[model samples]
Target chain A: MISVLLIGKGNIATHLFEAFSNLKEIKVTQINSRELDNIPNADITIIAVSDDAIAEVSNKINNNFVVHTSGSFAMTHLKNKTRKGVFYMLQTFTKNKKVDFSKVPFCLEAEDKNDYQLLEKLAKLLSEHNYNIDSEQRKRLHVAAVFVNNFTNHMYKIGNDICKENNIPFKILGPLIDETASKIKTLSPEKAQTGPAIRNDEETIKNHLNLLSENNKEIYKLLTKSIQNGN
Target chain B: MISVLLIGKGNIATHLFEAFSNLKEIKVTQINSRELDNIPNADITIIAVSDDAIAEVSNKINNNFVVHTSGSFAMTHLKNKTRKGVFYMLQTFTKNKKVDFSKVPFCLEAEDKNDYQLLEKLAKLLSEHNYNIDSEQRKRLHVAAVFVNNFTNHMYKIGNDICKENNIPFKILGPLIDETASKIKTLSPEKAQTGPAIRNDEETIKNHLNLLSENNKEIYKLLTKSIQNGN
Candidate 1:
């Protein structure tokens, strides 16, 4: 049985703790950042704190193998004098919603082979979709994630705003949003792309622009231009 | 049994034809737009052609009840001497993929009460998620869809581009994309928003912008600003 120590109490930390707790073979202990002095002795210590708090939290932990659950941070961010690795789950976590770790892509990184195996074993306990990704690749993945998750959510916000302004139910766009995301699984976003921008339907584009607010118009124009330029 | 004539060979028309054909109570006859001269008589004729072809195609059909399936076009765009209505399915249609119209949101509009009921009945046969949306409301829904579907897909395209440039598989971000779309179903997108921009983490935003290309940089900055401004 592998023993694990989880640091922080944020969304990622809470969800990771719940996911780890479900596995019979893994024994896990979770502590908030304030309880740094009581760091438990475990096979692996995971710092699942905020990006700004990762290094500071890692400094307090002294374990044989240390890992962080941050996509942007490098393994070396853990200044602890021990084996370091990253156990970044490429997903967004909400406090109330339960996450199925099995579908989540875990990007694991470690310098030592034994440490890598340990991390991979632990990751496999939580998800079947784990990968051995380096810091560089994980960093790129985080940026790509921001576009897919954060920016994409912003587009939904814009749609909701449009719906609210027109007194239409935002729920009307739910299935369309789901379909848009699902399409990318089978087709490349380039191939799945369909809009006035792709067709270069100037009249429809103009009509849409007329309906949008100034800021939305700017976004619509820029994205339309990007789509038209085949970006 | 209700007899329906579908005009168009495009993605929406084909999918509508397949969806309607599955129902034993509905008999659907699909014809390509090029065969407009041989328009068939039916209880209701639906012109599911391109937005540009909707008017011209509708002009050829002499059915008592005529409708065009377009989100952007108004019901009056159907220039047929017969009764007019709009049947807009608010989902992205791909040529090779089969769409489960049951989950698709159908926005129905008609001037006459009987025509409206006919269109609504047809929509209900395709989807349980039908709405009796007027032309104005449908127009807003269409614009909102552009943001939710088109703009959101562009964000995915950008993410794909970033992953390709970094030599990381774009599929790595699939779960994140799916989760982002799924979250909005329960939470408003504004409340669901998260990222460096939303958190106002200038440092991380700066790092991301530095890694992006010139065109991507512009989008990143614009979207970041939009997010920061609470739009």
Candidate 2:
């Protein structure tokens, strides 16, 4: 059985607490990041707090195994004398959204063999997608997440803005959005791409540019140039 | 029975012909655009050739009602002497990938009410998603599609490139990609936006820029600035 103590009341921590509590072989305890004075003992102590608070919070925890959930922060940042680790889930955790934990990739790290195995065992219980990613690799994944998740959503926002201005319903693009996301699984994004940029359809490109407002026009031009250069 | 003639055996025409031929109410005939000399007559003639060939192909069809399946081309561009219309499907059609007709948004346009009804009836026979979209709105939709589908996939390509360089399996980011696409279906992309750029976390942004290649660095900065300015 694994006893886990999670610190932080934010979205990531709350989601972790709930997920851990559901497993029969796990005993989970949660506490706010501010209330670290009387921190409970556990086999695994996870600090799922903000990036800025990670140092201060880890400095106070005296658990046998200390891990932070920050993608950017390294496991060595943990000030505890016993051991250090990282249990970063490589997916965004929203407050009310139901996360399919089975699909969430758990990027686990530890200094010693025993602690690494323990974390791996716990991760295996939650998800099949477990990677022994070190700090350097985690840093790469973090930035990639920004492009595929956050920046990709921004593209959708611009599309929505265009639809709104033209009195077209935004949902008309739902199937295309889903297809774009799923296509990468089978075909690499580089090969799956299709549009004016890739085809060099200058006439269509000019026509599309005339339809866009000032803000997206700048974006439209830059991305087009980038795609052309890369491809 | 409705006699439907489809010109051009490209991706869109092939898919449409397959869909129409499956229905018992529709008698569909497909011929290559090059074989236009022996043009068949039908109640509805669909010239699904390339955008450049749309005018020449439609000019040859002597059917009662004629439609071209080009999103950027206006319905009035069809030189059919009898009647002109459009049957634009707002989803990307790959050669081998199966298309879900029910989810495809059929943007139909016609010169008169009777022609519009006939197209609507045909669209309803194949799929539930039918709209009386004009040339102007379709032009808006075409540009919006470029943003949502084409540009968005480019972001995924950049992310994949980062993963390849770091030896991180690109599939590790698959769930995150699916979630990002699905999240926008419920929340507006404006509200759905997250990550360092939206939060104005300069430290994380700087770190992310350091990880990207020289090609994606410019893209990262531009998208980051755009997200900040818009949000």
Candidate 3:
């Protein structure tokens, strides 16, 4: 059986706890760092703390095969230990939704061959629910995710505000929104791109800016200019 | 029978052609500006051109109840001597897919009461296929659309690019992306917001920024700051 010690009990940690606890041949001992003394010793110590606390949490663990669950960070973040690795799950997770790990990609990294082999075996086991990933590639992916998921969601919020201000039913835009995302699944975004900025329709763009709230107008102009520049 | 003269052969115009052509009382005629002088006179002219071209195209029409199929632009853009209005379809149109405009919102605008009534009748005909919208409401919805449709799609593209750079299958992120958008159906985005930046985890944000490519790093930082600032 693989004994796993999980540190932190927040959103990501909770999911990891639930996932690992449900698996056979895997025993997970979850610990809130605030209550670390209660945690049982284990073969693999997985630190799931915030990035600033990674080094601090890493030093507290005295075990082989210590790892951290973060996509952007390196295995070196766990350098104080003998066995160090990464088990970063590259998917946006929420507490309410049940994610199928089988489709999630686990970005894996380690300091040495033995540790790499051990982490790879664990990753393969997890791969029953996720695809195995590598660090360098995952780093690039993390960046792209920022653009697509985080920034895009923010735009949605902005759009909602616009709708509320204009007495328009935001639901009216739902079908169009779904179609926009669906198109890119089959076409590259560069080809799928449309609208005033891409069309270079200055009049419409100007009119759109005019309709925006003063602050949003600034954001609209910035984004429009960015889109126009093709970045 | 209503003689509907469709101008411009773009995405929106094509969809309008299919929808209006199917109506019992509507006879649709599509004309490209390249062959402008050849078009026959009609009761209604739908100028489904780019926003910048709406004014120019409306000026060329000989005589008719002209309408521009743009949500952002006002009916004033249609400088036609005869009746003028906006027949804006408040939905995103793609070339590959079929859309049912019966429930899709149609924004109606006109100078004269008779012309407005004519559009209202036309809108009622479309209501069988979609929803009816007015000019001011549609403009607000259009701005909101920039966030939901255009901005969100761009974000997905970013996520795809991130996955591509990391040697990870972008498909892995698809389910999560879909869920994020779907969550809003029940919850407001303000309450639904998640991720490292929203948590105010400066360390994670810094690490994520460092993980990105130089250009992407700047984008990540800007967006992270924006989210943090609540913009």
lDDT leader:
2
Q: Per-residue alpha-carbon lDDT of model 1 for B1-231, expressed as tens digits? A: 889998888888888888888899899999888977767799888888888988787777788998888888988778899798888889898888989888998888888998888877888877899888888888878888998899899999999998888788888888899899899888888989888999999889988888888888899999999998988
Q: Could you give candidate 3's fraction of true interface contacts?
A: 0.56
Off by over 4 Å in 1: none
lDDT of 3 by residue, B71-164 (tens): 7777765777777777777677778577777657666777777887787787787774344556677777777887777667666766776676
* Alpha-carbon deviation at A130 in model 1, angstroms: 1.0
lDDT of 3 by residue, A11-111 (tens): 78888788888889788888887775555778778888876677888877777778898766766756555678887876677777776666666766777
Fraction of true contacts retained by every candidate, in order, equals 0.92, 0.86, 0.56
Each model's lDDT comes to 0.87, 0.90, 0.73
Q: Which candidate leads the pack in TM-score?
A: 2
TM-scores, each model vs. reference: 0.96, 0.98, 0.82
lDDT, model 3, position B61: 82
The top-ranked prediction according to DockQ is 1
lDDT score, residue A156, model 1? Answer: 93
For model 2, the superposed segments whose C-alpha errors exceed 4 Å read none
Interface RMSD score of each model: 0.9, 1.1, 2.3
DockQ, each predicted model: 0.87, 0.83, 0.49
